[model samples]
Target: MKTISIFTQKGGVTKTTSTINISGVLAELGYKVLVIDFDTQCHLSLGYDVDKETEYNVEEFLNSVEPIRYAERGKHQNVSVISGKLKLSTKSLKRDSLKKPLKKIEKDFDFCLIDCPPKPINDDLGFGEIAIFASDYIISPVDYDAFTLDGLTTLIITLDELQQREKLTAQYLGFFFAKVEENTKDFKEAYRELSESEISSLLFKSYVRKNAFIRTSINTGESAVFLKPFSPVSMDYRKLTDELLMKIKIDAK
Candidate 1:
């Protein structure tokens, strides 16, 4: 299976939302997708509405214990989720702790998407590091704001450091704007600057436009792609997902 971590150093950039909708889109295409909620807040778990009924959360998966089974079925067919718990931050897990567990279930899924926390917790080599070490690819969802550049820089530095020190294996897919306000002057300027920068090649051609229905869909325990398929918000996600699939050369099974 190809494992991807939806990550960025900054929060409130729709990281969790992207993971949810991307999984929804992949599942819609008949891919067996597994989503791991690695954030301490457990927002991804809540988004899938699998928070309460799960027999085990991601904590057990990280613990590397015997007889552990945390994969909870998602609302969509061909989708499974391993819920996240708030107490996960306290665990002292090695940077590569998640790799082995995920490897065991590699053949069971077509794709594994991890919803990473905004920043490292517990220590420098925390959940974020663990997630990256276990992933085959990384995708960052950026926002149009003053801090966007700083966040992207930090993420790039972190990945570089990991590559040099830890032999990081994950390939950086690219960046796509999430919750974008395309009509605004600030967005236009930010997009232009990023497109002209040194990492310009990493900018995706498709983005997710800002929409009220995105938040409403998550709050109501459904992904916008499935909740309102014909809406602009849903269409944006579909286009973005399709673009990403093309980049990764993944076809529907």
Candidate 2:
């Protein structure tokens, strides 16, 4: 199975939203996808409308020594979710702890997508490194801003450092712009700068446009793609997923 983490150090960049829609599109195409809520906010879990009262969550799974259990299913038959908890960041988890547990069920799904929290590499939360260590690839969702752009650089540097020190095997797949408002000057300037930047080659051609469907999806507990399949933003996600599959060299079944 291919494991990927949707990550970025900055918040409000639609990391969780991207994870949901990408996985949703994959499920729509008949791929068995597993989504892990690695963030403390539990936004991804809630987005899938997983049972909140379930006895097992991502934290429990990580901390438990027992056998692996079945994951909670979403509306889509092809999708399974490992829910997140609000207190996950408060606990101290060992680095690479998620790797072994995930290995137990690697054969069950075609792809595993992790919804990581917005925490810097050096932060005490430790969720960032844990998710990265467990992933085979990392795709960051970036916003149009100086801080967000700088955060991308920081992530690259951090990944390089981890590669040298911890022997991290996860490849930095590339980045895609999310929540884009193309009519804005900020968007134009940022897009131009990104195109001319040293890391321009790492940018994805598809970008998600800002829309109300995306904003309403979390409350509806469904991916925007499934909620409004023909919407422009949803169509953007489908194209983005296509590019993602190409980047990973995986054919949609």
Candidate 3:
């Protein structure tokens, strides 16, 4: 499987939402997808509505004793998930702890999407390092704010450090804006600056406009794409997924 990690250090970004929606769209396209919720809050698990009924969570896999299991036929056909738990937040972890366990499960799917925890919650590296190390490609959601640059910088720095100190096999597929406000000048400026910067080539074409239905659809145990495929929010996710797929194709060249 091609493992994709949706991660960023900044909180309140669309990490979980983007992870589920992107994977949902992939499932719609007939790709076998597996989602791994590596966060303590377990929002991805709850979004999939697999939080309570699943027999295995990331905690069990990370422990390396229990065999990895999945919540089958999750919200969509061809989509399955490994849920997340609160215990992962406090659990002590080594640098490559998740890598081996993920290897055991990922090969079964066409793609594996990991919903990473926020940086400040666990520790200096958090589950971020392990997740990144295990991924083949990464898609970080950037917000249209001053902090966006800082967050991207920190992410790139971390990846560089991991490549130097540990073994990281992932490459950036590109980062896209989430919950965007297209009409605002500030938002436009942030986009422009990023597009003109040194890492300008890493920017994506998708603009995920601010949509209230996103959270509402997700909270009700359905991805926005599945809940309202024709809604503006779902349409936005489709664009993001399209751009992501295009990027991946070009990268394969």
Write one digit per residue (lDDT tens) for candidate 3, span 1-253. 8888898888879899999888878988889998888888888888878864446887777877565677875355788888888665634777678788877776688999899877832346578767887788988888877777787887777776666766677887778988888999988998888888988888987878899998797778777887788988789888888888888788778
* Residue 201, candidate 1: C-alpha displacement in angstroms: 1.1
Better of 1 and 3 by TM-score: 1
Clashing pairs in 3: none
* Residue pairs in clash, model 2: none
Rank all candidate structures by their lDDT, best first, as comma-separated numbers. 2, 1, 3
TM for every model, in the order presented, reads 0.91, 0.92, 0.91
- Candidate 3 has its poorest 10 consecutive residues by lDDT at 120-129
On residues 47-131, what C-alpha lDDT tens digit does candidate 1 reach at each position? Answer: 8777644558887877766675655444566778888887666357777788989998898899999999888433467677788
Q: Report the CA-based lDDT of candidate 1 relative to the real structure.
A: 0.83
lDDT of 2 by residue, 106-213 (tens): 898999999999888885647878888999999999998888888889888889888898899998888999989989999888888889988887898889999887
The CA lDDT of each predicted structure is 0.83, 0.85, 0.81
Model 3 TM-score is 0.91
Off by over 4 Å in 2: 64-75, 89-92, 123-125, 250-253
